[model samples]
Target: MKTRKRLRSLGVNMIACLLSLIMLIPIVLILLNSFKTSQAASDMSLALPVGGLHFENYTLVIQKGKLGVTFFNSLLYSSGSVLLCVILSALAAYVLSRNRSRLHRFIYVFIVLGITMPINFVSLMKVMQLTLLQNTRIGIILLYTAIQLPFDVFLIYSFVGKIPRDIDEAAVIDGCTPLRLFYSVVLPLLKPVLVTVMVLTFLNTWNEFVLPLYFLGSSSMWPMTLAVYNFFGMYVTDWNLVSADIVLTVLPVVIVYLLGQKHIVAGMTAGAVKS
Candidate 1:
């Protein structure tokens, strides 16, 4: 029985590893072929470059695509939006979860509705124009914050509910004001959920193309993803440059995920189970 159980576990592990490799093959192919010339890539897409390392593709893409500027814009937009979402969501969730009232429940339901409702681009466009937010980085950032608020709020609320009420009561007894209690007592305890919100928000905003495309009309304001799309269109035949751009665009998120995978998994699982 012990031998059989061990064999079953090993089999499952093997299957999981195989599936992971299968999912990673495309990414690996793109990274490898990014070094190859267009002809080489077309001839043998799967194989790595034959003639040593080719840094030219990276240089060309960076220079011609203006990837540096676009990358900075993406970083600014994603980071700023995620920061705002985490702060606002954490505070909102704390209030809703801690303060039990009909109004709190209504607000929670409204936030959930934000998550359920599909983004209406037509209506959104009109709102953008009315708000004078069209064709601007700030517009994209604000839109991202609004779109992502629901999920972030939900995650934080669930986690906050798991926290004991004694903490809040004790803080209040100690002459801590509401804002001070939140910033000093509650925020620290909600670190896990905050990390989860930050990771999700960053990924969504970084990969978001539709909003940026519509709101950021100036090529100078394009994010990395949109810039990559433009690069592909202009250099349709240049597979090397295209692949390099893809690698560059995706590398940051990949690195972030790798670094924070544990926190993300733990926070999400804890929130889901607690809720």
Candidate 2:
């Protein structure tokens, strides 16, 4: 029995390591190729760089891609959307979780329906036209907020429900207003889930391509993903620059995930075991 258990453990470890390598291989290739010259990259696609590093590809991509502007645009869209989503979702979730009523159930179902239905691009476009949100940052921000709300509300509601009602009662007894109780007491207890929602929102907004492609036509307004796509179109034969752009686009998300992985896991697991 001991030997069987040991073998199973060893097999699982090996499989996990293999899966990690499989997932990492493309990223590794992109990083290595990003440093090669176009000629060298094409000629020895799989080979590692020789001697000194060739950072000319990075310089060229920076110049050609207008990466700084694209990165800034991404920052604005992602941060703004996330802020709106978190605040609105938290409020809505708190109301639904703490105030039990038939109306709360109806609202919950309505929000959940948003998650189930596919986005109607045609209808959304018409709505955008009426609202004059097309080709505007505010429009994109609003759209992202609406699209992301359902999941955010659900996640936050789950966490909020797990918090003790005694806390709210005590705060009210102490002459705390609803807003004060929520802002000062409830919000702090929701930190874990809020972190998870923020991280998820950031990633989704950052990687979003189609929405921005349709709405943001201005080159100056392009985000990292759009910038990378434009770079590829212009430099179709320049593999080195393409790879470098890919690396630049992917690196930030990777860094964020690594930094927030612990928080993300804790947030997701917060309500799993009732305290």
Candidate 3:
């Protein structure tokens, strides 16, 4: 039995390793191809690097893409959106999970519909024009917040429902105000789900292109996604620089994902299994 179990474990490990490599192949190819000459990169070949350290493409991308500005813009939009969306969604989730009224149920359904329904850009454009938010960071942040709220609320709501109701009662008995109860007691308890919301929201905002393209007018406010899109146009044939740009764009997401991966897994499973 011991030998059999060992063999099974080894088999599983081998399979897992194979899967990891399979997923990693494209990324490896991209990195390798980025170092190759423009023609080689255009061919998308994975052969050993021929050209020694082709830094020109990277420099060209940096100079034209205004990578520093766009990187900062993406960071601001993603982080700001995450911050606002998570806080509001947490509060809304707690309330929705605890409430049993028809109105609350309707509101919950309406919010969740965002996940199912596609965004109507025309309506959004009109709203933005009305609010004078057509070309600003705050406007873009608010849009992201709205777009992310439904999923965040739903996830956090599900997670919050698992917490014991007795805790709320205890907090009230101690004369804690509703806001205080949430901030002091409930919010900390929802950390796992909150982290999940933050990471997911940040990723979505960071990678978004459509909304930014329509809403933001100034190149100064462009995110990495838009920058990458424009850069691709500028260097359509220069695959080395394009690949390098792709690497730069993806690197932060990889880092953020690795850092918050534990919380992401925990949050994904938090309220799913009753046991």
Candidate 4:
């Protein structure tokens, strides 16, 4: 029995390693090719560059890609969406979880259904046009917020259900208002899930290109993803510059995920056991 279990564990570990490599190989290739000369990187091989790294690829990418402006654009959109999504999701989840009424349940179900629903871009564009939000920073930010809200609400709703009601009662007994009860008391307890929501929302907003592509007509308002797309078009044959642009675009997401990785796991699993 012990031998059988050990073999099974080893097999699982091996499969996990294989999967990791499968996902990582492309990223490794891009990183390697980003440092090579344009001619060398053309093959997009895994082999290291023969000469010194072409560090200018990054500088050229930044200048030609308009990364400075697009980086700011991405940061603004992501930060705005993360802020709005976290606060609104947390509040909505708290209210719905605490109420437990049929209407609240219906609302929760309706919101969660969005997780699986396909977006109607036609209707979305019409509404954006009607609201005079097209091609604007706030419009893009709000669009990202709406896109991410459903999953954020669902994640927080589960986590909120796991918190004890006694804390709320005690806060009320202490003469705390509803806002105070939520903000001062319950909010702190939701740190793990909140962090999870923030990280997820930020990553989603940062990586999102479709919304910006459809809505942002102006190149000046484009995000990093759009910038990368434009850069790719201009330098289709210059693989090194393209790889460098891709690397820079992915760098922020990698750093953010690595920093919040532990919290993400903790938050997701915390609600599973029903403490």
What would the per-residue lDDT of candidate 3 be over residues 77-140, giving only the tens digit for each residue?
Answer: 9999999998899999999888989999899889988877798998989999999999999999
Q: How close is candidate 1 to the true structure, as a TM-score?
A: 0.92
| lDDT-based ranking | 4, 3, 1, 2
RMSD values, in order shown: 2.1, 2.4, 2.8, 2.7
Question: Considering every candidate listed, which one attains the maximal lDDT?
Answer: 4
Candidate 1 lDDT by residue in tens digits, 1-275: 99999999999999999999999998888888899977887653688688887889899889999998999999999999998999889889989988899999999989978878998898889999999999988888999999999888887887888899998899999999999999999899988768878887898899989998777779999999999999999988888889999999999989989988986786557535633
Off by over 4 Å in 4: 1-19, 266-275
**lDDT of each structure?**
0.88, 0.88, 0.88, 0.91
Ten contiguous residues with the weakest lDDT in model 3:
266-275
Where does candidate 3 clash, by residue pair? none
- State which candidate has the highest TM-score: 1
lDDT of 4 at 183: 93
Model 3 spans > 4 angstroms off: 1-22, 267-275
Q: lDDT tens digits, residues 169-215, model 4?
A: 98899999999999999999999889899988888889989998899
Superposition error at 275 for model 4 (Å): 8.4
Clashing pairs in 1: none
How accurate locally is residue 181 in candidate 1, as Cα lDDT from 0 to 100? 94
